[model samples]
Target: MLLSVEKITKEFPIQKGLFGTPTAYLRAVAGVSFDIEAGEVVGLVGESGCGKSTVGRCVVGLHQATDGRVLWDGKDIAKLSPEERRTLRRRFQMVFQNPFSSLNPRQKIEDVLLEPIAVHGLFRPSERAAAVQELIEQVGLSSKDLQKYPHEFSGGQRQRIGIARALACQPDLMVLDEPVSSLDVSVQASILNLLTKLNRDRKIGYLFISHDLQVVGYISTRVLVMYLGVVVEEGRVDQVLKSPRHPYTQTLLKASLGASVAVKGEQLSPAQVVPGCAFYNRCPHAESRCSNEKQDFQEVDGVWRVACWKWHKIG
Candidate 1:
């Protein structure tokens, strides 16, 4: 396995007053487990606040997981010391969702890319300039772009810079959090193509996090559907997208196409609540048993797993 997330859980403390005492916990990621094989792209799909980005941050060591382990190449990152973790950073990198916000507006592109290389001591000072120029060209940018600030480039160009920075250390795994969601359709297509080419040439593994099912379907070898901080379904991209076992997964597919076009007799309210099935409130086929009993993930086929009671009866 390239990466393994075993029973990971991340929670945030809620504060109610000025001198805030911890009131309740907001569970962002709950008991999520999955494995990514070498040179594979695993797409994590969910709504905005369903903790897709949070999970990505934990995988990259930005946010320490509240519970469970993030294993990279068989080493548990959470168990590593500060210095050890810093050394391990070179093997894994991240491309954030918003390119404009991720870049330093005050700094030139050269400085931004140079920082990672310098910190990791990857190259000597004399060779760093040429290396940076090479990285620019690798991402399809001109050497002239090195002198310009982020604001001087278009959204797609800024993203290329972000990709170049992430690749500076020659990482094996990249956690891309909605990398192209902020760009125009044309720009998004271009960036996606660039990423696809990079992956094929470099053999880089990716943990792609996004809410757009269509986008995920386009790039992922496998798909994992998340809801209310938990995984409800997981399978090969073709299997999951074509025949979703869990009702939540079905709703997500339908809703992606159009809100009103979802399962018949189901009108999903934004504030809908489900006591058991996180998707029970919006699921058209919800039964009394769905609301009373919690479902556990069960493997249906060799490659597909689902956490739903009515998988056989959903049709």
Candidate 2:
């Protein structure tokens, strides 16, 4: 495995005092596990605030998990020393959801691309300009834009620059959190195509996180559907989307097709942590057992996994 999320869980404490006393903990991601191999795209699909971005951050070491391990190349990043992480930084990188906020407004495009190389000693100062030019051309941007700042570019161009900045590190794995969500629908295709080309030509593995199932269906070989921090369904993109086993997955697909899948399961409290499946309260096919026992992942057809107790009975 190029990257492995080994039962990763992250929680944020609700502070009640200035000294960081916790009154309660908000579970952002709960026991999530997945793997990404070289030159593969693993798509993570969920609604907004479903802990998609949090999982991405944990993979890249932006936030240490409250529990569990993020293993990259057989090593747990949470256990790595700060210096060790810095040394291995080039091996993994991230493209944030918001391009404008991620890039520095004051820095020129050339400086933005070259600075990481300079800091990591990937290239000498004399050779940095040549590396920057090469990356710019690779991302379908001109070398002339190198003199411009982040604010000067349009939204799509800024995103191209953001991608170029990530490529500057020469990373082997990239966690792109909604890389094209912020752009125009027309422009989204070009960025998606660029990402596909990068993955093809550079042999880089990707953890592609997005709320759009259509985009995920088009780009991913495998898809993992997340709901309230837990993966309810996982399978090949075509299989899961075309014949979703989980009720939540069905609802999503139906909604996308302009059909309403009424979500009238039960009244659910966001703060309540249940022992059973997180989607149980909202699962149209939920059973009585689903209220008491947490559904464990089970193989249905050797290629797909489902966490719903009544997955076989659904549809």
Candidate 3:
């Protein structure tokens, strides 16, 4: 496995005051497990606040998981030495949701892309300029724009720069957290195509996180549906999107397709840790067992898995 997330969980402590100790914790990601092979694209789909971004952050080392392990190449990342960690950092990169916020307003585009190369020592001074030109060109940008700051570009152009910045590391995998959500529809399509081309030419694995099912469907080979920090359903892209087993997954598909599905339960809060299935209240097919008994991940055909005991009845 290129990357393996073994039941990784991340929780944020909710403090009573600025200086006080935490009174409670908000579980942002709860025991989510998945693996990504080299060159595979796995889409993580969910509604807003469903912990999609949190999962991406955990994968890229932006957040230290409160529990469990994040393994890269069969080695636990948390256990790596400082030098080893620095070396490992070059193998994976992340592109944030907001391009403008992620880029520095003070620095020129060349400096932004050059930082990673300088840190990693990927190229000597004589070779660095050519490397930066290649990186910018690979993302469909001109070498002339390298002299400009981030704010001078349009939203789509800024996103291309963000992608170029990530590519500067020559990573094997990328964790793209809604890379195109902030752009116009026309701009979104161009970014998506650029990403597809990058994957095809470079064979970079991707963990694409998004709330939009259509966007996920367009770019992913396999998809995992998350709800309140738990993966409710997981399968091939066509299998999950066309024939979703979990009620929550079904509801998402309906919503994406402009078909309305009534939410049957009360609003759920991630802070309120449920003993049973997280989607119990919201699931129309939820049983009494779903309210009290924890749902184990059950395999359907050895390829698909769901965390709902009532999936069969719902299907």
Candidate 4:
């Protein structure tokens, strides 16, 4: 596995006052687990605040998980020293959601790309300029654009530049958190295609996080559906999207694709702990046992898995 997240959980402490002891915690991610193999695109799909982005952040080491482990090539990343982690950063990178905010307006695009190469010492001083030129071209930009500021480009073009910046590190896996969510529909397709082509050519695996199912289905080979900080269903893209077993996944598909029989329920908070299934309140097929007993992940077709106790009966 290129990346493996084993039951990782992230919690933010909620303080009572300016200097008071922590009273509670907001559980953003609750024991979410997944893996990405080399050259594989694994989509993590959910609505806002479903903890999908949190999972991506944890994978890239932007956030230290409160519990469990994040393993890189079978070694726990949390155990690495700061200097070791810095050296290892070149192998993994992240692309942020908003292109407008991700880049520096004050710096030229060339300087932006050069910073990583300089920090990582990827190339000799004389070779760095040619490397930057190649990086810009790989993402479909010309050398002239490198002299321009980030504010000069459109949203889509800026996003392409962001991707080039990530590529400068020559990473093995990228954690993309809603990379195209802020772009126009036509622009979104271009960015998605660019990502697909890069993955194919470079064999760089991706953990694509998004709230859009259509985008996820288009880019990912496999999918993990999450709700309220936990995975509800996971399987091959076609298996889970075409014939979803969990109610949350079904609800998302219906809501996104205009299907009927939509599941509905009151909005719930991640901090609100449910004794049983996190989705028990919303599941139409939920039973008394669903609200009483916590459900374990049950394998369906040897590869597919669901956390709902009544998955067999629901779908």
Question: Which candidate has the top score in lDDT?
Answer: 3
The reply for model 1, stretches above 4 Å from the true place, is 16-20, 263-275
Candidate 4 lDDT over 143-257, as tens digits, reads 9999999999999999999999999999999999999999999999999999999999999999999999989999999999988889889999989988999988888888888
TM-score of 4: 0.97
Residues 170-236 of candidate 3: C-alpha lDDT, one tens digit per residue: 9999999999899999999999999999999999999999999999999999999999999989989
Stretches of model 2 off by over 4 angstroms after superposition: 17-19, 265-270
- Candidate 1 residue-wise lDDT, 1-315, digit = tens: 789999898888764556787666677888899999888999999987788888999999888899999998888997888888788889799999899899989999999999999999998899999999999999999999999999999999999999999999888899999999999999999888988988899999899999999899999999999987889999999999998888878878887887654454442322333457766766778788888677788887887989987897873
Whole-model lDDT values for every prediction? 0.87, 0.88, 0.91, 0.91
RMSD of each: 2.5, 1.7, 1.4, 1.2
Candidate 4 segments whose C-alpha is farther than 4 A from its true place: none
- Residue 50: error of model 2 in Å? 1.2
Worst 10 residues of 4 by lDDT: 258-267
TM-score of each: 0.93, 0.96, 0.97, 0.97
Task: Point out the higher-scoring one by lDDT: 2 or 4.
Answer: 4
Better model by TM-score: candidate 1 vs candidate 3: 3
Q: How much is 284 displaced in model 2, in angstroms?
A: 1.9
lDDT order of candidates, best first?
Answer: 3, 4, 2, 1
For candidate 2, the 10 contiguous residues with the lowest summed lDDT are 263-272
lDDT of 3 at 196: 94
